[model samples]
Target: MKSSVNQFSTQFEWILNVINVGVHIVNKDGDTVFYNKMMAHIDGLDREQVLGENIFQLYPSLTDESSTLHVALEKGIETIESIQTYVNLKEKKITSINSTYPLYEDGEIIGAVEIAKDITKVMSMYDQIVDLRSQLAETHKKNKFFEGTATYHFSDLIGSSPAFQEAISLAKKAARTHSPVMIYGPTGTGKELIAQSIHNVSAQRNQPFIAQNCAAVPKELMEGLLFGTTKGAFTGAMDRLGIFEQANGGTLFLDELNSLDLGLQAKLLRVLQEGEVRRVGGSKEQKINVKIIAAMNISPDEALERGIIRSDLFFRLNVVTIQMPSLLERKMDIPEIVNHFIQKFNKSFFSDVRGISQKAMQRLLQYSWPGNIRELGHAIELAFNVMDTGEVMIEEHHLPAYLFPSGKYSVSNAQSHHPPLKDKIDLPVVLEEMEREMIINMFEKYNGNISKTAEALNIKRQGLQYKLTKYGIEKVYAAGSKEPK
Candidate 1:
């Protein structure tokens, strides 16, 4: 009688425990030896229904081919957490993530126990978080500009004035459409920067972005540089691919468009219109899929009227025009530009120049900069050369003498400090000294190009010849001859 009472107590404990949601089980030959209420809740099977049923028959989704249970059974130590979606006996589909572990008895495999938590809500929340994170990433990417080649976007353009903002707005709109873009702006107004930003944000971001100044190449070589030439087209000519071909499926930023002679404008127009270019000394025309972004200070209409640019090409290039505002017009950004340049120069030159002074800032503001941002950059560089302290207290004296009262704006004042007769030397001798320095400097600047240096200083051939004689500058560099005295 005591044995029977003990057996009854053991049976009652097992039966009561099965009512709770967690399933405890051992199956031999696909028959459940133990069960829990949790397992019943997850699978929607009563303890009685699951007790003697084959595991695969009850959950048909967990087969040897497609189930984690099979892998655990095969490996004997594998655990798998998987989600299974199936229709219940009531025809309602249910999804449950089951974490199955293999059960062993007496160092021999018996079956597996699956602990499943209702992860539908968890999964739903996880998906929402992922979506929100993606949106946040996109927002962060959009807000961050100039961070790198990949991070730039249209929203990062900083400008408040209508003129500046309107140009950026048009650039943004232009980026969406795949068409030729012409940026009109004076030098150093960030034309190339704007072009790069546009290219970065455009659909062709992954493609090539090639920039070339039209004026930098010789006029006679323009055709060969733009369109490849066949072998033996010219002396020492080996078949070479031109820039246009290399920039296929990408952008080609032709800066200084006004510098290209009118003869080449017709050739450029053909490429824009027909999407084809015939190589110099080659008859075959090759189709090139390239987007153009031309930059020039001169207006297309003005160039067309002056016969500097072909009228047809002007129309083709003027499809979309973005006019970059001069830095003077956006004086509000001067401080920002100054700070940016200071940081940049500090890094580049390895100097500890912290910031510009209040007086220096005022000087920059009051000054009418003819050279624009380029001149400002140069001035900062010059200041670094003269700077002894960390503070860049750029006074008017720190500026180029030409930019001061002693330059083009010089006017005689009686009270002004005047040098004595010795200081006011002979004009001819002074002119000679100036000419010597200019010739020496310009020669170096032009890399010994007589025509280029002369053209740059806007002096005639005979005039340059006269100055060369007056200063006794060398006509042509003989290997060991003195350059200038």
Candidate 2:
């Protein structure tokens, strides 16, 4: 039995040493019992020298509170995917993602085993991406003539609806101060436009204005982008200025701020609180004078509920919150928005499209634009592209096919005049007939494919079949076939 146990111990040590990840095992007293070569390589230490030493003594920088292995052993707890950063005995800064779990023998805790994966290279690559983006932003700033400094001022924010005007009123008040502003609105509701207007009217109007979409950047790269990086911080990391430093004495507009990782959000909260940022690899923090304007497609409350935005960060950014109304909320502005797009496309396309017809405008108003102003703008652009050179008006025919997929209002023919009613019309019967007609049209359009027809009509196939039977259109469906039935 003793010989067999000795062989098992030897095999276990061999397996631990050959594994890819770094492994360090410590007894209940926190003395290193097993330290693998991978752990030695990761920490730039000698495996032979590390064995039998007190973990705290080998890496004097780590304490009982900070070291995962020590904490697990002391508390009999497990730590998973905890990011740990510490300077090694050689004074080399090492960053790793660690998972530490307590070991048990005979129902009693004996020691702790820690598994670590060095993420220094991954962080280095993220720093490089941040450096490149900062360089591009700097280049864009220098050539302001080409990029054109945000031309949309407060005057250009075109909406007179009460909800929109109330938002603008709050924004104008916010622009007068250096306090951080948080703007919340649905996508395509011009959140960035409001950010630009705020910057253009702020005390830092002439200073650099930098806008970055948080969602556009990879989550891993965001921290280094917001906070500069320093040399020797990680492998291949170099000294570089982040967006915060670049936009010093100016406004740094972070669009879709909720998309930023919560861990990075804590770092951002620190910057907002201290008005300073330290580079990724550097030891010293630098002061910054930046006006932050954060925009989110989701409401701050919703983001908080989803745990996407940190509560502390949200409270800090909520100093001046402005909720921009969606296009649906301000349908009164659609006509003016449509006209603006028409003029915009006329200049770009060099076409002389005059205006949209009343019927087309009615169609625009009747439809619920889920994409808000951006979708409306796209619809106008699509219409302009299809209009002929001699065509002066943007008629319903010029609109995109997706806008009226049911072909309910095809502009191929003029509006049919209905004869005067002699008595009270059976409204429900008329509506039922219209619904049945629409279902039949969809069925025909999808070539009797029940699945496709049901999907197009936004109904289940079984429900569509019931409707077909109720309308006596069951003949359209073939038995036991995928078609209509």
Candidate 3:
């Protein structure tokens, strides 16, 4: 009898230590018969403390309808997927994934056995990954839409002016050919949008359409970005393809061509002439099948005078030119553009604002838009946000003060007082006059702080002073004056 008891005790201890999941056994009357170390470890309880305790006494609700233990006994079959939370002897709460089934003897239900595993880490990781995937999906959607379209090609262009229509027609025609395309326009005239649209409409639409802003690229990184690099080509590099290689067999639109560094301009010229690119560190020149579409916000005449862009590259790109009209030159498109932005902002902001007030519409039309279509879009978005109710009625006062400044309003009011001058000036002379007046206005706005005014106007201080002298406005500053007056 002693020997038999010793063998049974040894077997039970061995089973307790080897089990991976928590294990518990209960008699047919729901009293605890055997509990293992794994069970105690999972529940954060002491094995000795759980001895002879009634299973239902600890968890009173363990009945046939709700508990797996009850179902196992009633059906005399294995019961799985029972979930329960337990408070260990130390009073700490822990969740367990519990499964129970009948402990059988030949064909009789002797008792029940339960198994559980801790799933806290698994559950936490699952939730985190799910959240990350959702965020990534949203970002991917945004990138896809923005990267696929350029300005004015789709309904987003929001204009139907004669100049705009002409530009689009020319762009569509040029897009059909594989020749290099050049787009000329003033700042904020949606040059990139036209470039992207041409690429999307072209035969190579399925291939990558890479759009790069030449002015925005850092001087040091420009070469590598345009041509690519081999493994360990530079610090922290892992063999990356350049923009030319990435946009192979598709359109590669380089914006602000005037801003390219002069030395790098030679390499670009070669690429245009040869249709091939050599990586920054590699000797082998790789052929690129990319279609080049270069854009400049400055006119060809101004570009020549500035000596910012190479003459050879200009000739290559100017084979086909698409001149995008500025908003000030196409006043007829303002209303349609305004309506489109209002509708777009409404959808994005979940606002019910139907449209703008008549006064607001007139105010938008009257303003001399410096930022063009982009500025108009921003103004509408700002108005929609500041409007009080769901139904936003944009008024003249709701517009940005910069659009209808006090001085500009006064000028409009005094317009009839000053009779129109009978001067049939050439385009160059008129542009010069406009430039002089703008500089004067900027000086006055800055309170004659030359440095601040120059910075605001995006011109060097010396450049501003030179212009002031050329226009004979330096006399105002030379008369021991601290201000422009």
Q: Which candidate number has the best TM-score?
A: 2
Model 3 per-residue lDDT at 74 = 71
lDDT (0-100) at residue 233 of candidate 2? 52
Expressed as tens digits, the lDDT of each residue in 1-485 for candidate 1 is: 99999999899767756553355454646566666777667666778877777666666644564444555566675543454455444444455556678878897778876655554454444334334433443444455431323344555455576778888878878788689899987666667777877887787776666677887654655676677666656422346566677566667789988889788888888888899988777889899888799998655676777777776777788889998877678877778777767777778757776777775677688765534566566566655554445444444444333344434222231112321222222355334434555665676566556677788788875466556533434433322333322
User: Which structure is stronger by TM-score: 1 or 3?
Assistant: 3
**Candidate 1 structure lDDT:** 0.63
lDDT winner: 2
Distance from true position, residue 450, model 3, in Å? 7.9
lDDT of each: 0.63, 0.77, 0.70
Q: Can you tell me which runs of candidate 1 are displaced by over 4 Å?
A: 1-159, 389-396, 407-485
lDDT by residue for model 3 (1-485), tens: 99999999999879876878888888887777888888887766777878787776655434446556766777776755444544555656555567788988988898999887765454344334334433443454456543432334544455778899999889889888899999998777888888888887888665666777776544555676788666645422336567787677678899888989987899999988998898887889898898899998778988987799888889988989989887888999888888888778768867777778887787888876655777677667666554555445676544544455563434333234222322321345334545755776777666677887789889888678767644434323323455442
> What tens digits encode model 2's per-residue C-alpha lDDT throughout 431-475?
555576587667666677778888999987767866764554433
- Per-prediction TM-score, please? 0.53, 0.60, 0.57
Residue 419, candidate 2: Cα error in Å is 30
